[model samples]
Target: MTLTLTSLGGAGTVTGSRHLLEYEGRRILIDCGLFQGYKALRQRNWAPFPIDPKSIDAIVLTHA
Candidate 1:
């Protein structure tokens, strides 16, 4: 089994926290929160996601 983790957002700053878990050719999104505060952070909200949304198999939001 192969598993890899990718940080879609929320790294250095605090706001949108999203991560992609790829396992066995399946992609799962954890914490689908919105990016808030600061233009840089909020700008991510408008920009296209690093990965394809349709490719994501499931979304598991950790919190509201």
Candidate 2:
């Protein structure tokens, strides 16, 4: 089996938030979270994820 890793969020921003993932045969989501401050940031919390939540395998969080 081959694993493909990707980052879904937190490319340049801080907040210690990031979404690292490996998906190919199996779909997985890393840190899916909301950042503090900024209305857009907060909105992401309620917004629908790009990938279906049901498809996510695990949610890895670096910090709260």
Candidate 3:
């Protein structure tokens, strides 16, 4: 059993808190948020997702 956690966002800043958890051949996304702050940060919102959205097995949002 191999499990890996990847931080898609919210590493340094306080917005766009997204995390990807992969285990047992399953991909789980946590906290799908949007970037909010300076223009540079907000521009990240327009960038494409790191992985294919369809590849995710489930999404677990930590907050609304």
Candidate 4:
């Protein structure tokens, strides 16, 4: 399986944070954190994640 990665948050903006990971026929999510300090950033949490949560096999949060 091929691993894929996508930045869901904290890239274009500095508010909410989210990351999507896929590898070896497995999917994972990292740092489903909310961005603080700005309304635009905070609104990201309300948006849908690019990938379905049900497909996630693991979650790894570093200081999340």
Candidate 5:
């Protein structure tokens, strides 16, 4: 089984925390947050998700 982690958002920036984990044909997403603060960061919210939302098997939110 191979486990791969991809950062969909919140890498260089401080907001929009979203990470994708794939293992054993299962895709799990960690944190589905929105970008806040500056206009540039907030604009990211308008962008489409890197992957299909229905493709995600599960979602693990760390906080509300």
Candidate 6:
């Protein structure tokens, strides 16, 4: 079994928070908030995701 963690957002700033976890044969996502604040951060929202959305098996939001 193998485990991998990737941060889709919430790296060098606040607002949008997303974390992708892949283990075994499953891919789980935690947090799916939108970016808000500086233009640069917000612009990130428009960019394509680092990973494929279809590759994700499930999504679990820790907060609203």
Look at candidate 4 and tell me the lDDT of residue 28. Answer: 77
lDDT of 2: 0.63
lDDT of 3 at 28: 98
Candidate 5 backbone collisions, by pair: none
All candidates' lDDT scores?
Answer: 0.87, 0.63, 0.94, 0.76, 0.94, 0.87
Write down the RMSD of all candidates, one decimal each: 1.1, 2.6, 0.6, 1.7, 0.7, 1.1
Scored against the true structure, residue 62 in model 6 reaches a CA lDDT of: 81
Model 1 C-alpha RMSD to native: 1.1
Off by over 4 Å in 3: none
Q: What is the lDDT of residue 42 in candidate 3?
A: 98
Question: For candidate 1, what is the lDDT?
Answer: 0.87
Worst 10-residue lDDT window, candidate 6: 6-15
Model 2: colliding residue pairs: none
lDDT of 1 by residue, 1-64 (tens): 9899989888887778899999998999998877888787788898877888899999998877
TM-score of each: 0.88, 0.61, 0.95, 0.77, 0.95, 0.87
lDDT of 2 at 64: 60
Instruction: State the displacement of the C-alpha of residue 8, model 3, in Å, after optimal TM-score superposition.
Output: 0.7
Q: How do all the candidates rank in terms of TM-score, highest first?
A: 3, 5, 1, 6, 4, 2
Query: How does residue 36 of candidate 5 score in lDDT?
Result: 92
Expressed as tens digits, the lDDT of each residue in 21-64 for candidate 4 is 87888877888878776776667677776777788899889773
Deviating ranges (above 4 Å) for candidate 2: 16-20
Model 5 misplacement above 4 A: none
User: Which runs in model 4 stand beyond 4 Å of their true positions?
Assistant: none
Query: Candidate 4's error at 3, in angstroms?
Result: 2.3
Return the lDDT, model 3, position 44: 95
Better of 3 and 4 by TM-score: 3
